[model samples]
Every structure is written in structure tokens, then in C-alpha cells.
Target: MIRVAVVGAGLVASHYAAGLQRLKRAEIEPYGVPLAKFKVIKDYVEEEVVSAYDVDANKVGKPLSEVVKRQLEGVVPVPPDVPDFEVREGVLASSGAGLDKMFPVRGRDQKLPLKEAVEEIAKEFKSDNVNVVLNLISTEPAEPFGDEGKLAKALERGEVSAGQAYAFAAYLAAKDSGKPVAFINLIPTPLANDPAFVKLYEDANSLVLGDDGATGATPLTADLLEHLAERNRKVRYIVQFNIGGNTDFLALTIPERNLMKEKTKSSVVEDILGYDAPHYIKPTGYVEAIGDRKFVAMDIEWITFNGLVDELIVNMRINDSPALAGLAVDLVRLAAALLEKGVKGTFYDVNAFFMKNPGPKEARNKARIKAYYDMISALRELGVIVE
Candidate 1:
């Protein structure tokens, strides 16, 4: 069984936890509940509530048991046999990763030193046999700008970040554990892109990949549009506008960070269309207190030589985290399989199908999914298993 440690225990983190639990047969342990279910306090009442943590006075020092009760608020409770995990304090300075207005405000607690945090994570891995770390934190638009080496050294030296020490601190800690670590980023952050970070993982003989997990309508829309374009269909322009009250949406409200997300999302579509398809992809708005739902509106324009133009408009709303959280569960198992088989950085197929921003763009639609299956099959033929 691959013991995977989830970095953040927020709303999305909860979904990731649930998704993993759903895959229990596949060996994914719950880090907590899914963010959506967390809101449905009544639903978790009888469900198994694993580990949960946040920096909030209301919840800061609360025990795992209390946290579970508080989370239940008005929801139904499950059987008493359902176990609960501890709610640690100062795991983060702020849920600023995205927990601003959507979820309850986190309390201000003394932050953990980066060194101590790393040591805690490393110790957990060493003792628990955690093989990979999945970052289901908020959508941190700001990516690492080539400073993972500094971050890695800080972990070794016990350096901690209270007010935004480099974001890759968690990645470095996982690497330092000396256990083969495979990191899957579901948010649009750049930890996996920096050369230094990549090298650190490579040097450690571990694996790291993913800048974003392409969940929900984004991937569904992108792949579908690509299908039309590949068929020699004329794609004049594409515009995708999205809005949600989820933490991911709440996090991108920062103007600077929003721009980064816009550019990254736009580029994914741009790259898929090859320079031929003009397009705009942006997170249009943030609706607070709606819990965890994402609404997407997409418009596609195509022209035919007959001098006529055709347009396609589509709307989709997804339960933000669950749509992609399911994939994250698969990724942990996939990562373990790769490590057990001695695969190196960026396993292409899993990254392509499961990530928003893969290392490279390949053919869209069935071809892309097919390619991924082939890659995993090849690896399996090599007899890789999670050690």
C-alpha cells in the first residue's frame, strides 16, 4: 500500500480524501473529507472522517473528534465506528492558498518552521511508508521561479516559511524523505516547472510532474474543441469564461494571480489549436457562499469556405473538486507504479490525461486518452508496482 500524504486539509483537500477513500481497494488512504462534503456537514456525520487541519481559532486547537463534530454542524452523523484524524495547527499561515471568503476564515496561529514542517512530513513518510505527496491545496497561481534548490536546502536545514517562504517547501520535504516521491499538482502552480525543482527530484531519483490538474469543463471542453479542429473543421475563435465560488475560484480573485491563471488556461487551448485557433480562456468571476460549484460557458466559432459561419456555445457546471479529485486518486496509484518500476520524471500518459498543463501537448480526444493507456500499459509490461 502506498501511504500518500496530502499537504492541505481544506475543502478541495477533503474531496481528494474522499476520492482516495473511494479507491481504497487501490490503496489510497483518506487525508480528510472532500471540500464539497465538508460543506454538507450533515453528510459526513456517519462517514469516516480521517485527518483534518487548519489554522483557525474556531478550529485551530480543536481535536480531530471535535473537528468532525463541527464539520457535521447540521448534517447526519455516521456510525461511531468511523474514525477521525487529528486536526493539527499552523500547517499554513493562511488558507490564502484560496480559503478566503468561501470557507470559514482560518485562525492566525504561530506558523510551523519550514524545517519542522519538512521533518514532520519526512517522519510520517518514513514511519508510514508514504510513497507520494499529492498537493490538492488551493489554486496558487504564482509558480516557483527557479528557487527549488534554496527550498530544498532550507528543508535540510529546518527553515520554515510563515509568510510565504517559497511555495515548493512541501515538495522539497517529500524529496528529502529519501522515499521516491511523485507530486501531482491539481492547481495551476509552477513547482514542477522550475529547473532546480526538477533537478532536485531527478537527483533524488524520485519523480515530479504536473503544473495543473485539468479537471471539470476545462479538460472536457479543451478535448472536445480539439476534436473539431483535428477533423479539419475550421475553428475561427474560442472563448471560455468560467465562474465559481469554490476555493480555486476564490483564490484566483487576486488580480495578479488571476492573470497567471488566465494566461495558463488560455495557453492550454491555444497550444491545442496550434496557432490556427484564435481564443480566449479566462476565469470570469467569483461567486461567494455558493459552496463548491463551477459554471463554465464556452463559445466556439468556425467558418466554412461556403462563406457561411457556424458557432457553438456550451455551458457546464461541475462540482469543482470531485470532477478532478477522482483523477488525483488514480495519479497516486499511478505514481507508485512508476516509482516501483524505476520510471523517472514526468510519466507522459498520466500527466497528459490527468493534468491541466502536461509537459507537452499531444493529439486531442480519443487519441490522447489512447496514448495514455498505451504508456501505462508499456510500464505495466515492465512489471512496476508500488513498493
Candidate 2:
């Protein structure tokens, strides 16, 4: 079994927990999960969320079903089989400010020493035999610790971000248990990209697989850029923005928090187009009424043959949280299978397809179409996928 632990019990986590249970019960088809049609080393039924953590005062100590019901009551049916484990208090570290604006914040770090809190969380992972730990917290402002010594110093000073703290806890869990763990980061913090964290996971014989999930507008924008690039279209300029009502969007209203999304979202332009296209791509606003379905608008102008200027405009309303939740379903199983195959450290092929900024610090973004085939090919060669 691929036992999993969730780091945040927010909207996305609610969707993931509820949707996963429904998938297991065969109550709904796995329509949104990308690799559901393919045969993978780990079956979807083998995946289970054994534990979850959160820093919100309202969420901590509450059952996941209760949290899912509170967030998804009328929106979607809360799965009756969703895990009943209490959501433990997670680390706050440098992430408290933005989260504090949304709800009452209380992290284990606030009550115990930061390291002790991490150890406590790690103990749970070891006890639960968690093979995959998903970081689905709201975006927070953070910089990479390029060196292991620097990371250790930051942890000692309690200056690490919440993602970093939880990553360390997973590392500790792997080290103590002598079992491999996959820390799948679905947030913007730099675990997969940071050499320090990558090396740390390598030492623990574990894996770290992200920087940011490529869920909504960013992946679509990437493929459009690729289409333009392949057709030899000289892109004049591109503009893309999203506005939503989720707590994540509200968190982005903070300048620093928003900048984190900008870095991950904007990287696709330069990486895929082979030149930095003049573009504005990021979350622009938060409207409470818009809820989890976000509004996306994109405009691109390009120079065609005969000095002609052509323009393309696209608009969409995307279910933001459930989209990532679907991706999480695949990632959890993939992470466990990769670990079982003795693939430690970070894997770029998987990250390239799933993450906005695929990691190991040097990887670049690729169009989702090409990335999808390339990742499938790689996984096949590794015996992680069949047929």
C-alpha cells in the first residue's frame, strides 16, 4: 500500500481526500486523473491518505471528513470513506503571516521548538508508514537554501519556511525508518529545485518531486507558446492572468506571496519560447464570489508572414483546486512506485510534466503535450509503466 500524508487540509486537500475515496469505492470514474487509463506499477486502489496536517486553528484536531464537509458541503459530496484521522497541527515558521490573514493560525512551532515540532510530525509519518507526503499549503514567500549548511543554519535559527520544515520532517522519517519516502511538493516553495533539499533527500534515500504544480492557465499557456514556436511564429507579446476566490487567491493579494506564483508561472515563457517573450502571466486578483472556479484570460500577438500581425484571445473558467487534486492522485502513486524501483533523489522526467518549474535546479519548462509523451516514455523505460 502507498500510505500518504497531506500537509494542508484546505480546498485542494478536501477535493483530493474526497475524490480519492470515491475513486477507491468506484463510485465515480477517474476522469480528471491524468494517468488513470495507463497501467502503472502502483494501482490507484493501493493509494491511501493515512494522515494530514494543518496550521489553522479551525482545522487542527478536526477529522478530515469534517474539514471536507465544511469546505465542500454543497459543492461536492464528502466521501463517507474519507480517512477519519485528526488533522495534526503543522509547522508555521515563516508562513504564518499570510495564513493568519485568512484564519486563526496556530502551528506546532508556536507551541514547541521548531525542530521538536518537525520531529513530532516525523514520528507520525514513521508510525503510519507514510510513503508519500503531499505539500498542498497556500503559497508563501521563500528563497532556496542553496547549500546544505545554509539549510541547517536556517532550520536552527527557525528561519525556514513551513514547506522546508515539513520536508525536513519527511527526511527524518525516512532516515529513522530506513524506508524511502517521496515528498511531493504541490506548492511554490523550492524543495525540488533547492540543491540543499535534493541532497538531503538523496541522503535519506527518498525523493522530492516539485516546486509548483502546473494546474490551470500556466500549462495551457505553455502549449500555446510551443505551438507558436513550432510554427516559426515570432511572438510579439503575451498576456495571461487569473482571478479567483479561493484562500490561495486571497493569499496572493499579499505582494510577497503573489511574487512566488509569478516566479513559477512566468518561467514558462522564457523556457519554452527560447526567449523571454514580453508577457504578464500571474494571478491578478481575488474575488470572493468566484470561489474555486477561477477566471482566466489570455491574449497573444505574433508576427506572421508578410509582416502581418495576428492575435489570439482565449478565456476560461477553471476549477482550480480539483484540477490539482486530480494531478495529486497520479503523483502519489508515481512517487511510491519510483521509490519502490529504487529511484531516489528527484526525478526530472516526472517533474517536467507535472510541475510548472521542474526541478534539480537546472531543468526548464516544456510544453505539456511534449512533456506528457516524454514522461510516459521515460516511465516505460524505467518499468514504472506498462503498455
Candidate 3:
């Protein structure tokens, strides 16, 4: 069975759990999953959320199956069998301090050293089963804890991001158990992209997939650019942005946090176009009433066949979290399958298509699709997927 651990038992995590349930029951009309033929859904139904972590006092000690009900109010139905495990406290740095004003979040009553915290959480799920660490925490700006030496020193201050600490924990757990593990980063943190962080994961033999999930506008934009590029269309300028009312949006009202979101959202633009096109792509605002459904608008202006100025305007209202949750299902399953094939570190085949800022920073969408097909072939070769 594929066991999973969630870094935060928040809305997106809940949506992911719900999506898993749909797959378990063979009901998936709700999640508009864009996969061509995910024969892995059956394998995914074997999944179980074995552990979850959160700093909210109310959530820390509760059963994940129970606490995630809060997310049900947001509209996704929760599965009764998602499994209930005690939510543990995760390590958090100043980046999380800002959220306290908005929600009642409290990390370990007593701050634990970084290594201690990593070990603390790692001990819970170190069995022989495959594990995937999913980080769905609110977006926040953070720097890598750095090399093992620097991370060791930083831990002395007991200030490390939920992303870094959890990643380190997965590495330790994978090393100790000699089991294949994966860290699926659904937020805008750089675990997979950070050089020092990737080295740590690679050294420990754990697969790390991350940066930011490309569920809505971002991935769509990549494809649009690829279509233009393949057809030899010159792109003049593009404006892409989204606004939503999720707790994440509330946290992003902070400029530092918004900048973190901006960097990932814009990371794909120039790469797919082969050069930097003037673009303003980022989270433009927060509208609480809209909740998890985000409004996305994009205007692409480009030069056409005869040097004529043409524009492509698109708009969408998407249930952002669920869109991401759908991709999460594929990522975790793919990670488990990749590990069985002796591959490790960043899997751009999945990351490039599934993430906003895939590791290595750039990929054209058409190339990503080809890589994705190649990955599927590899999976079939390894018996990870079958018709």
C-alpha cells in the first residue's frame, strides 16, 4: 500500500483526500483531472493517509479524518475512510508567524531543534511501505536551511520552515528505513529547486517533486505559449493573473508572500517562449467571498503571419484547490512508481507538467508533454502502469 503524510491538514489536503476517495470508489466526475489515461488510479486507490501534521492547536491533536471536515464546508465531500491519524506539530519559522493573526496556530508548545523536529515526525511513519510527503501549507516566503552543516547550525535557533523541516524529516526517514519515499510540494516553496535541499534529498535517496502546483492558469499559459512558439508566432506581451478567496490568499496579502507566489507563476513564461516576453503574471488580489474558486484572466498580444498585431484573451473561474488536488493524486502515485524504477531526485516529466515552477526552472509545454509520454512508457516498462 502507498502511505502518505500531509504537512498541513488544510483545505487542499482535504480536497486531495476527497479526490483519493473518489478514485477509491471509482467516482471521478468531480475532479476535472487532465490525465490522458491514468491507469494508476487503481494503484492510487490503495493509498492511505497514514500521518498528518499541523501547528493549529485544535488540529494538532485531532484525527485527520475529523479535522479535515472543516474543509468540507468549502464544498468537496470527504471520504469516510481517509483514515484518522493524530496530527503532529510541524516545525515552523518566522514565515508562519504571520498566519497566527489570522488563525490560531501554535507549533510545538516548546520549540524543538530542527533535527529533533525532523526525527520527531519521521519516527511516526518509518515502516516498509512507500511514503509520500505532501506539503499543502499556506504560501510563505522562505530561504533554504542550507547545507547539512548550515542547517544544523540554523536548527540551533529552532527556526526552520515547515517545508525544509519536513523535507529533512522525509530524507532521514527514507535513509533509516531503506524505503522509497517522496516529498510532493504543493505550495510555492523551493524544496525541489533549492540546490542544497535537492542534494540532501538525493543523498538520502528520497524523491522530491515541487515548487508550486500548476493546476489552473499557469499550466494553461505554458501550453498557449508552446502553441505560439511551435507555429513560429512572435509574442509581444502577456498579462496573466488570478484572484481568489482562500486562506492562502489572505496570507498572500503580505508582499513578501505575494512575491514568492509571483516568482513561481512567472517562472514558466520565458522558458516556453525561448525568450523573455513582457509579462505580468501573478496572484493579483484576494476576494474572500470567492473562496477557493479563483478568477483567472489572461491577455496575450503577439505578432502574427503578416506582422499583424493579434491578441488572445482568455478567462476562467476555477476551483483552484481541487484542480491541484487532482494533480497531487498523480504525483504521489508517480513518485512511488519512479522509486521502484531506481530513479531519484526531481522527476521533471511529472514536475514540468504538474508544477508551476518545476525543478531546473524551465520547460516548454510541448516538450513537457513528450517527456510525460516517455515517463508513461518507462512506467509501463517497470510494470508500474498497465492497460
Candidate 4:
């Protein structure tokens, strides 16, 4: 069983916590392969919210299960132990890169330094393994420091973002344990993609995967691009965006933060299409009236065989937080299982299929398809579950 310590125990995490508990019941997975490996997902995979951190006063000292019910307005299905699982105080480093306009801040007196933060969090669990540290924090202002030396210096000066702080802590804690652990980023900020952070994880021989979790529009777009390319269609331009009412959308209203999200969303086009496709893709705006449901719009215009102009216009309204959280469940388990075998760094199999701009990206459709199968094989080889 994995004792997960979730940072930013907010909207998305409510869905992640509730969804994992729900999936623990016997049921068929709606998608993906290696059904043989997935058959025992419940038995080999389980999560206890050993600790959670959020700046919101209502959430910080409460049970994760109790908080999720309020977040989703009684729509969450929480397990018995979940209600007793305490939500610890979280440090909003630099107030989460100035996101206080949307999220609250916990007291400085209650938090510790980067290394102590990990040790303190580690002490919260009775489970032998800390398993994985999942960062579900909102979009934040970030800059890739280029190398470990600069990143370490910046971290010492407390100039890093909230997401970076949590990642550093997770790596340190795993190193201290002298056992396998993982850090999974479900947000758009760089963790796995950052060279400095990747180096840190490798030095510790732990797993770090993500930059952002691709749930709806992004993955669909990737597959569609593959279809057009295989058919030898020349793409002209594409436009896609999502507007939602969640706290994350509110946080993205900041230009610096929005730029971070846009980078991840837009990064896929050039690599996948084989040439730069003039595109506009990002989290466009926040409409509080929309609540957790997100509004997505896309326009793809391209040249097909024989000089014909074809345009694909699609509109969708999806339940955003829950969809992304469902993807996170699989990634966390994959990271945990891989770390057990001393496999560190990123997994393109999990990254390409699950992330928008997977690291060292395998943007081609054929490669992504193969990556999915490879992920199943890797999981099965670990024997975490059996058919």
C-alpha cells in the first residue's frame, strides 16, 4: 500500500482521493491495455492519505474525506479510513508564487525548512514506504534554472515556487529512507522536465514523472494529429482552449502563471505534427458560473490530399477535475512500481500517453501507441499485480 502525501489538497486532489477509493472496488477499466496487469489493480494498489497539505483554513486541519465532500458538494465517495486521514498544514512557498488572490496561505510558524519539511511529512505515516509525493498544486510562476547548481542556490534563497519546494522535499526524504520513492506532478509546472530536478531525482535513484497530466483535449489532439499525418495531410493551424471555474483557472488569470500552462499545452504541436503548426492553445479564462465543468473549444484547419481545405471544429463541456484526477491514479501507481526496481527519472510510456508535453517527447502517434503497451509490460514485469 502507498502512503501518499498530497500537496495542495484542493479541488483536483479531492477528485483524486475520492476516485482512487472508488476504483478500489471490483470493476472493469474503461480504457487502456494489458488487461492482464490491470486485473489486480485493487489488490496491489491502495493509497492512504497519510498526510495532506493546503493553505485553506477549512482544509488544513480537517480530514481529506470530509473536505472532499464539501469541495464536490457531496458527490465524492470516500472510504472509511479516509475521513480519519488528517490534512496537515502545507507551506505555500512565496505564497505559491503570488497565487494568494485565489488560494489562502497557512501560517509560517507551522512550517519548516525544505529538508525538515520532508522529514516532518515522512514521520506522519505508519506505512513503511512514503511511496510517492503527488503535486496537485495550482499553476505557478516558474523559470527553468538550467542546472543543478543554480537551482540549488535559488532554492537556498527561498526563491523557488511552491511546487519546486515540495519536489525538493520529496527527493530528500526518499534519499533519507534509503528506499524507493516517487514524485508525480499533476500540474503544468516543470518537475520531470527540468534538468536540475531530473538530476536530483537520478542522484537519489527515485522516480519523477510529469510536467502536466493530459486528460481531455490534449491527448485527443495528439491522436488526431497522428491520423492526419499518417493520411499525409498538411496541417495549417489549430486552436484549442479550456475555460473553467475551478481554483486552477482562477490562478491562471495571472499572465506569468498562464504562460506556464500555455507552454505545456502548446508544446505538443510542433513535435507531433513534424513541423510547427500555428496554434493557440491554453487555459483561456475562468468562469465561476461554470463551476467544475469546463468548456472546451477547438478549431483545426489543414490541407488534405489533392489540395482540399478541411476544418475540424469541435466543442465540448467536460467535468475537468475528475477526468484529470483519474489519469493521476494510474501515473502514481506506475511511478511507485518503477521506483521499486530502481528505475529513476521519467518514463516516456507513462509520460507520452499521460502528459501533454512528455519529456524527450515521443510526439509521433505510432510511438505513443507503442509507449502505452510498453507501460503495461513494465508494470507487469514488476509483478505488482497478476492476471
lDDT of each: 0.56, 0.92, 0.76, 0.72
* Poorest lDDT segment (10 consecutive residues) of candidate 2: 93-102
The residue pairs in collision within model 3 are none
Q: Output the lDDT of residue 92, model 2.
A: 94
Q: How far off is residue 240 in model 4, in Å?
A: 1.0
Model 4 RMSD to the real structure? 3.1
TM-score for each model: 0.75, 0.99, 0.91, 0.89
User: Which stretch of 10 consecutive residues in model 3 shows the poorest summed lDDT?
Assistant: 360-369
Model 3: per-residue Cα lDDT over 1-387, one tens digit each: 788888888878888887788787876663555553667533666677777888777788888888878668648566677768778777665567577877788765257555676676777658535388888887878775446677757656656676777777788788888876898888888877777767777777778988788878877788788888899899999998789998788888888889998888876777788889899998889889988889999999999887899899998999878778888877777788777777787776677767787774333433455546776776677666776
Instruction: Report how far residue 24 has shifted in candidate 3, in Å.
Output: 1.4
Q: What is the C-alpha local distance difference test score of candidate 1? A: 0.56
Candidate 4 accuracy as TM-score: 0.89
lDDT of 4 by residue, 11-66 (tens): 88887776666556534352332232465443324666567777777677887878
lDDT of 2: 0.92
lDDT winner, 1 or 4:
4
Cα lDDT tens digits, model 1, 226-257, are 67767656788888888888656766787766
Clashing pairs in 4: none
lDDT value, residue 220 of candidate 4: 76
Off by over 4 Å in 2: none
User: Model 2 over residues 206-241: C-alpha lDDT tens digits?
Assistant: 999998999999889999999999998999999998
RMSD of each: 7.0, 0.8, 2.5, 3.1
lDDT, residue 332, candidate 3: 78
Task: Give the best candidate by TM-score.
Answer: 2
